[model samples]
Target: MEKSVSKKAEQTLKKARVKYPIGVKLVVIITVLLLVSLGTITFLVSAMVSSDVRITAEDNNFTVNRRSATEAENKLNTVRSNVFLLLDMLNAAGSSAALSRQASAFFFERNQDIAAVVIPGSLELVNTRFFVSNEIETTLITLFLQNEAAAVRRAVAGEPLLINAAPVFGVPVIAMLYPWQESGYEQAVVTFFSSEDLTESFGSGANSSFMVNDQGDVLVHADYNLVRAGANMANTPIVQAMQESGDRNLQLLYTDQEGNRFFSAFRKISIGDAAVITSIEYNIVFEGIAATTRRNIFLTAAVLFAAILFIWFFSKTISSPVRVLAAAAGQIEQGNFEINLKAKTQDELGLLTDSFVNMSRGLAERERLKDTFGRFINKDIAEKAMKGELTLGGETKHVTIFFSDIRSFTAISEKLEPHEIVGFLNDYMTRMVRCVNDTNGVVDKFIGDAVMAVWGAPISAGSPMADALNCVRSALMMRAALLEFNEGRGGEKKPIIKIGCGINTGDVVAGQIGSSERMEYTVIGDAVNLASRTEALNKPLGTDILITENTYNLIKDYLIVEEMPSVTVKGKEKPVRMFAVVNIPDANDIPGAGAKGPRTLAEVRNLLGIKAPDMNKVDTDAEEQKYKIQES
Candidate 1:
């Protein structure tokens, strides 16, 4: 039952461990910490990189936009200055068609950006449309210029307009008119310059450039389709913001109508109310940083996996030994001192395992010593001997000596095989020896089918009287034990057996007695011889337990006895008294026997199936050798 409960507790401990293994906890704890630390570091790095890259990208966009704007403005400025030079030369050569033709040719030569030049008729200048191409080019330019006749009127009305887009010409064009003051007549020259040159300077990429007028109308853009479609960007957030902003150039991040975010930089030029603008999608601007963040995530995951694997193996190295030690502890708890364990490492766990092994060995040795000596000596005496506290030489002790022999043992042995004889002795002696040991008697030796034991030798029950009482109690106990041993034993190999116990109390020499190589603990003197002789007399006397007067005197009050006829010792003239023990009165003799113990000699004789002895017909020579019985 104790083993079962221990097994249940171990199972409970196993169930509790299902979720809380040291290896798993180590992996989880370390993984979480790695995740937190790596995640925070990745976030911080990405944030910092994004911030720096965004600023750098914005600055780059602004720088490129401003340069493009300046290039376009300078081109337009050259056209304005060359047109003014032509007007001055024509004014100097008044009324000369040759000079007028020469001036127009000179202006067109200095600026090939000019597709056509228009001179409105006035007091000093002719309404001349100078075309530089064949009929096809002339017709195409003429057709596109006619659409801007309204802008000419606006220039004549002193508004002085610059229309930066004229995709009507099938290419990028800039048409501008400055108020002309010539000979006090209201007239103007409209020069058509190719802004296509600016398109060559632009690049199409994630970052793109385009020009827009004050009205936010796109012109000279890298995408010629927007110019062709006349796409108006007037409501564009960045363009509107640029228009409102007092700065000449600025960078901003804004979302378009499609919810697409953009990084945009705008620069206003000095000509034609035009501005150069560049923009890139926000995701494209930070794609590199996004890639870096993903790599950081993957790296952190890899490190976590590696660390978990390492911790698992490492924790197993530690916890496995602990598990083995726990199992060893259970084995020890069950009284199995022999253990199989080894220290596989040189760390603290290995040290603990080594210590456990030593402790188990010590216990096994102690148990072996108890087994070797305890059958022939008291356990306390064996312990004292192991600790070097027992005296090796003889000492006189007032002790009770007990001897019991099986009756008709030679006849019983002849009826059984040799193995059966051993088994029979072992079975019978086991019960009888328990009776002796239970009452603090040490078995001194076994002589064939007999047993010798001593009380109050080497160790005592405080006094001779105490030891004597214990010896007598053991004799009664053996009677009951032998009765148990004989039940259902009628077979040849397992014949019914009876034993007689003789107990005597006297001063005897007791100690370890033998040669240096072979030692035995025993008692000697007249008491032991008398006890042996008294045991042999049991068959003739019809008794199972007999005690000398010396033993009977110390335990008279505790036992019921019948005084037997005197027996004269072999060498003594006087006779020694003997008694037949029937019961121990209140000794708790057997289960359901009376509280006063078995009270009558008749009851004992009946229990043991002992027939009455006829001393008149009993004259044994073996008994005569030991004593002379004087029958009453």
Candidate 2:
């Protein structure tokens, strides 16, 4: 016995080994490692290439800065020439007595105007004028002091003057006189140029450019700092470098005291002898290059890091199937059936994957049994039966009962084969069952090609009228569907099928009512019998669907009907009034189609024109009571 047990254990081990070979395990490991290695190498190479590009961009930015500085200086020189020409006009007039007087009158003719004059040492106003009553008045000007020197002075004997000053109040004033008498007025005109205006014409090209005097004071910056105080380029690196080497063209990477780095280039502008240093920041030249490079580097690094991490994480997950399976089994044991395992290998890990397979098969088998039982019985009934609630004893409850049958099933069946007849019966029963279900009706069973359906028991149809109308509508819709069905099967040759639906809404006993060994669910009462009788009456009346007066009155609001004269229905002593349901009208019609018999109850009475004793004359409650009394 001990030897047999040992042999069995060895045999089981051998079978498992055969299913999951050693070679397959090696292959999985090698493949996973190779993928990880390739991913890591690719990430590192991309990062290195991006870093090199960043370095190249930094160098290019330095070169661009130098070129922009030179351009700014040239623009300033052009502006200087224009200003000088305006000043020369004043000087030429000062050289001639006639021209000078004409110049003074020109200023005096305008109100509050000062005659601008260029003398040997200064630019002055000879005659200041003022305005009064829309007339130029040289006498009314109280503040006309003439012969004032301008604020600007030439840096060298031959250098032109540069100045910008506005008049005070309405009095025009000019100062900053350059000595142009020795070189004629034409030479004096060349002295008046603006460095500030010159810098503005750079056309969105550079950030800013400024000139600094040798005294380390700001002579003129760009338009950005014209009104600002304490603006100068003297203390800037461009000036310091120029003073040190006297190199007009110089490049240096200078970081401001505020930590803003700049690639600066310096060039000296010489007017005769004095020099003005020009400086420009590199970012002003390159604009968005460095910032874009830095952004790209950061973005590339972030993407590479995320990619590597993802690859490593995915590789580790793929390598550990046993761990995943163990986790899944734990969840399944705890009743969490949503766990899924992805098989990545055909090795032992994949071969040992039968727990989920077995669990799924067991669950599927249980579900199939539950659904199959639910079809035979009501879903609630099947559930209750499964829980052992369906006992043999009967329980009675109030229900509305209905019964229906194909009007001529025997004649219809004779024309078709046995299989075809079965198909027809199934098709007819299915439509009837669907109708019953739609009205919250429960189908008890099929008695041959007939159906017994009930409402207001397992679930209530809300009102008796609604229950009756539901059965009527179902019969109408079934008849419509049967026409289509017959058309498909060669209508006339297939024996056109018709249905008779009878509905009676009243109180009845409904529950499981059969022997203990074989139980059945059904309703039993006088109302049930009346409903069956009404269905039989359909044949005699030549109607497809019929309902008792009690059923019609309950759902009179939702059914179109034609009345049949009072007729004696077997069990009842008094004659019963019946209606043949035609169609239910749409809500948008002139009159709702469901308005029984006609648009109004009067129309129904008029159309039937019956002279028999009115239904209201007989007490239905009394007749029902009499039937109960006789049954007891």
Candidate 2's TM-score: 0.42
Candidate 2 error regions (>4 Å): 1-356, 367-375, 378-400, 406-441, 455-470, 480-499, 506-530, 536-542, 548-558, 565-577, 585-632
Candidate 1, superposed: residue stretches over 4 Å from native: 1-334, 339-353, 369-381, 592-597, 620-623
TM-score of each: 0.46, 0.42
User: Candidate 1: lDDT of 98?
Assistant: 98
**Top TM-score prediction, candidate number:** 1
Q: Candidate 1, overall lDDT?
A: 0.77
Model 1, C-alpha of 176: deviation from truth (Å) = 99
Q: When superposed on Cα atoms, how far off is each prediction in RMSD?
A: 23.8, 14.8
TM-score, predicted candidate 1 vs. hidden true structure = 0.46
lDDT of 1 by residue, 525-624 (tens): 9888888888877888898889999998888987788988888866556788989988765777453243656577777788788998888877746444
